[model samples]
Target: MTVTEELVRKRAEHNEGEICSLEELALHQQDIEKIEFLNKNCKKLRILYLQNNLISRIENINRLKELEYLNLALNNIEIIENLEGCESLKKLELTVNFIGDLTSVENLVNLGTLEELYLIGNPCTDYTGYREYVIATLPQLKVLDGEEIGKSERITAFQNLSKHYKTILKSQEDYFYKRVCRFLSVNVQALEKVQAQQRRETFSKKLEENNGDIEKIAKEFWQEKGPYTPESRTETYEFLRLQKEQESQKAASFEETKPRRKIFFAEDGRPYNINEPKIEFKFYEEIMENEQYFVLDIAAYKNMDTSLIDCDVQTNYVRVTLRNKVFQMALPEEVHPDKSSVQRSRVTGRLLVRMPKVKSSSIIEPQNTKWKRTTGSVEKTESKDKMKGGKSNFLTVGETTASVDWRNITNAEDSRSGDLEMQKRAPVHRRKERENSPSFVDNPDVPPLE
Candidate 1:
């Protein structure tokens, strides 16, 4: 698991802009073996967490000048070196590591801003006069291994340092030789294979416990660890990163194997309809003076090239091509292909298609209209006087003209009886005038009531 640029980027946050803008990063428990790509990609990092990994050497991080905190706990790091460039570093955590070189505390003598150091559970912590040596060497350290160094303690450490200096060096050299001998005697390849097997077994057990569901196991594990913690965040990021890679690979394979489709007519000579671009659109029909038109509006991107769009209007349907995608829609009414037109709006980038409907002519015959006038008056002489003038009301149909003679008009018996029955069924509610209330009298001298 060599730390690559991709892994570093995936484990980082606030990196949407240039990589140099990254300030804080977490790469814990990722099995990363070496620190890489950060010195070039994230030179402005302020805080970094690289604990619980397989990293053995601290290198390639001298460019992080703004770093304030560095966590390298639970790693295979043996010696502390190459940290002279972190000018603003205030806290360093190297707990639970294999660091046995007590003389490595000399690396902090140049770090003036370093205030706290943690070397708990490390081989170097058990060295004789370890606390005194560290306190005397790094004078700016306010706390060491969860304990605060007082003025009196710092003075006593300085006083005892000269007496224990040669003894500490001798012990450090012996431990170094033993560490080298152990490193040479162990089978590195077999150890790595065992570690890998153990990890797989752990994963398999978790999967079985969750009924062989990877997602369920992952959810349970992260939930048990709680949220907003380093472990949970790291695990979640790794899971998502692997998922994205798998999805990308599957997509690439699918694209390579997918069959191309025909957009227009099929092999059977039947027209084909397809909407490969999957553009959202609206369609409607309008009528103006017996002329029907079909309007189709396609929503397209504003920056899309206008040359990519093509349209073909047919009698029963309209076909549109958008960036090699065929979009065909059926129209209820047939349209004239020659008169159809298409336009695109510059402001909204919408494809507007105007198709004129096919015109149809209907054959009709003119018929004669009969006119009859019914009057309540029964006097023939009065009707005759009314028709004496040539200005009679007449209706003309095509080339024939006709007029009605009121003197010869007659009403039907059923119509007259029906009218009389309707009048009888009417409920007329009225009050008769008060007869005895007052009597009207005309006065010549009195004016009307003011």
Candidate 2:
């Protein structure tokens, strides 16, 4: 073991009651359980720095009840779990880590003492934006990464995000907004609007009961739901409910219809797989950078059906209308016709389709017309075939042309020649080549008289 490895098992002791230690445990590679020992041994561990190590678990430190400041930065931690009940974590440094989610960390809202957060190297490089996200989440993160909010560099970031939020709250911005919204996650705006409408209803009802003026009531309504607080909405309110509702309802309807999109089957009674390039299309509902429930891209199931298709399909060039919004999308189209696919999942676009089951159809015996007899077969052709003098096959018009043969052309040289052949054969409208065109063969390879 090295000196640093020995330091991990180090214990600071004294004859006094207790001693607080800001442990700087660094560069201990492949040591996942290093903090596990400290959690059990170090009773006075205040600020722990187990960064740049292989510390994969946070639950180890969760046992450190006195652990006020923890720096678990630069680790391979995927989930931010088990840090919920640790109400003493005033400062958290999660930089340079693979942590992508905040599942259980949201409940750390009660830790009102959280002041500074260093989430630099992790996915959250934009501390300003992530601060707001964590603000909305933890609601207690004030000083994020040694920077003060509502002042300094953070104010501009907040102002920009505030505008984005404003655009979402403003009138129906664009077609995409009616499809999916953004910054609010999936359909948060719709949920908030429902809540806001309820609050407005309650406020309006209270105002009526209190016999307040209509203008004051409107102002109060704004105050309750305005950008600022309930007390400041009087002068800063715009009654855009009707318009916002229309957009919100469109989004809600799309969302309501989205989860109902059944996957895993094709129309011909076959299980759908994601590998089917043609049949696979994305079912996307995005909240844009400045819009609510906006449809970024949409595709019809008819255009995405690949059951009848055989080969690889290249739909990289596709222009279609989705929920009245025109968008250029990339997906697969019919390329290879011989390849049969049972699962449809490869195509990524704006929607995925689960084709309806091919229900069995009852055989309809000759109801309209009886079949006519063939020459040597006991087959009955349709009566219409008698008028036409021949019976037709069930195959399509071009089924016989499936395989392509390279031979059997009139001229082999024409087939092998370059595209220059077509350019040469093109009509030039020239009367005579000798009179109009310059002859290279008539002149020698030597330079002409300058």
**Best-fitting candidate, scored by TM-score:** 1
Give the poorly placed runs of model 2, Cα more than 4 Å off: 1-30, 102-104, 126-129, 151-450
How many pairs collide in each candidate, listed in order?
0, 40
Name the weakest run of 10 consecutive residues (lDDT summed) in model 1. 363-372
In model 1, what is the error at residue 19, expressed in angstroms? 10
Residue lDDT tens for model 2, 1-450: 122324654423232322235333333333343454555555556666666555555665566566678777766564576766566778888776644443335556666777777766554342234555554555456776666655444444545655434443332234224324532464766765676678768766865685443445556544553332211222222344333554576677788787432443457644333332333335323222322221212233545444433222222223333332333333222212122122333553234322111222233343345543345434434555344546443322333524546664435467556566677899898676555455446558779888
TM-score of each: 0.47, 0.30
Question: How accurate locally, in lDDT, is each candidate?
Answer: 0.76, 0.47
- RMSD (CA, Å), candidate 1 to true, equals 14.1
Q: Which consecutive 10 residues in model 2 have the weakest lDDT in total?
A: 228-237
Candidate 1 per-residue lDDT, tens place, 263-374, comes to 4666764565567788899887655456667788889767889888788888877888777667887676678899888888899899889888776433121133323333
